[model samples]
Target: MTGEPFKLGDRERDEIKWSCGAGLGLLTRYAPGDFTVTLRLQPENEKRDRLDLGLLRKPQEDSDIGEGHETWVPLIKNVTSFEISYFDPNANTWLPRWPGAQLPRLVKVKVGRSDTAVPWEAIIPLRRTPY
Candidate 1:
């Protein structure tokens, strides 16, 4: 789960600092469903050194109407430096952020710890279809 030929930019370094500072991160997840889920790292205490990974769910109907509720469900704890990237098939490149109607060919997630050198990462493939 760890190891990589990875590079860090100003943006990435800032993100790492922000995540560690607030002990929070936002992770996007796409699926064939009526709702959307975003995974987030939230601080477990006021110290902001420890965090919990959680999912925030919101129904499409609510988002469209602008009058609905969201639910937060925690998954894991003591997480840090969570980052994500999307691979655009059209552009044939990886992007730091995804904001398109079509699904990206691949989704890459990276998680790091303050105590470790290389971060843990995963590249997940998605259907090449438009939503």
Candidate 2:
């Protein structure tokens, strides 16, 4: 399960790089639990990427204390990036994430260009009304 759409900015791009460099992707899942969101990010690029799968959800009566209404708990974010790269301010080198996300806001396919510094199928799981 993926998400709707969430744009990526310099801040987000940087976050996903240093934090989850390898599995640098954001995927959402509409599971049958509290948080139905999963942000994929791999701090390293490897063959068998790792998964740091997490869940995102609003606040519930049994929810944690400090957590806000909209929060994401990383679950599968340890996967290695087979193609994506960060925006290097040093050599001016740059790469883009693969189209494995569920971003419906992007221009479907990123035409031309050898790389993209942003997410493709960006996952933005729709928030459900807490029961």
Candidate 3:
């Protein structure tokens, strides 16, 4: 996908909040299989003092539910960058997986918050990798 900066409206931000709270992860069946995930964190935001971000995977569709499993990777605070990619077993390399004609899957974003009255957690359903 292209490296472009997009603005999030109130509704969009609200949706993200709901999804995070829902704990089901973000489901993305949108277009453009390949893309970049960029989050600009402003620590000065009144709602939150710190934010933790990480990736989680659901091993199986029917078996796992709600934040299936947390990867060994540690969550990051303040600001961070990540790329989602799929392992191409045949090619013996990792490739960028994009959303196409496939059932929507949940990509969980393990969010940790501190010093906030309201907890904003979210999961991202990704059809592609970060690349």
Better of 2 and 3 by TM-score: 3
Clashing pairs in 1: none
Assess the local accuracy of residue 17 in candidate 2 as a C-alpha lDDT between 0 and 100.
18
| Candidate 2 local lDDT, residue 56 | 40
lDDT of 1 by residue, 1-131 (tens): 11112233421221211111112232344433355555656667787767666665665556556537765667766666677777777888877766555566787877766667887789877665455
Q: Candidate 1, after superposition: displacement of residue 24 in Å?
A: 23
lDDT of 3 by residue, 34-95 (tens): 22222323333468744234333223322344543422222366532223333343466633
Candidate 2 lDDT over 18-91, as tens digits, reads 11111223233333333323333323334553433343444233345664565555543442222223332334
Better of 1 and 3 by TM-score: 1
Which regions of candidate 2 fall more than 4 Å away from where they truly are? 1-51, 60-65, 68-78, 81-131
Ranking by TM-score: 1, 3, 2
23 in model 1: Cα distance from truth in Å? 28
TM-score for all predictions? 0.59, 0.21, 0.24
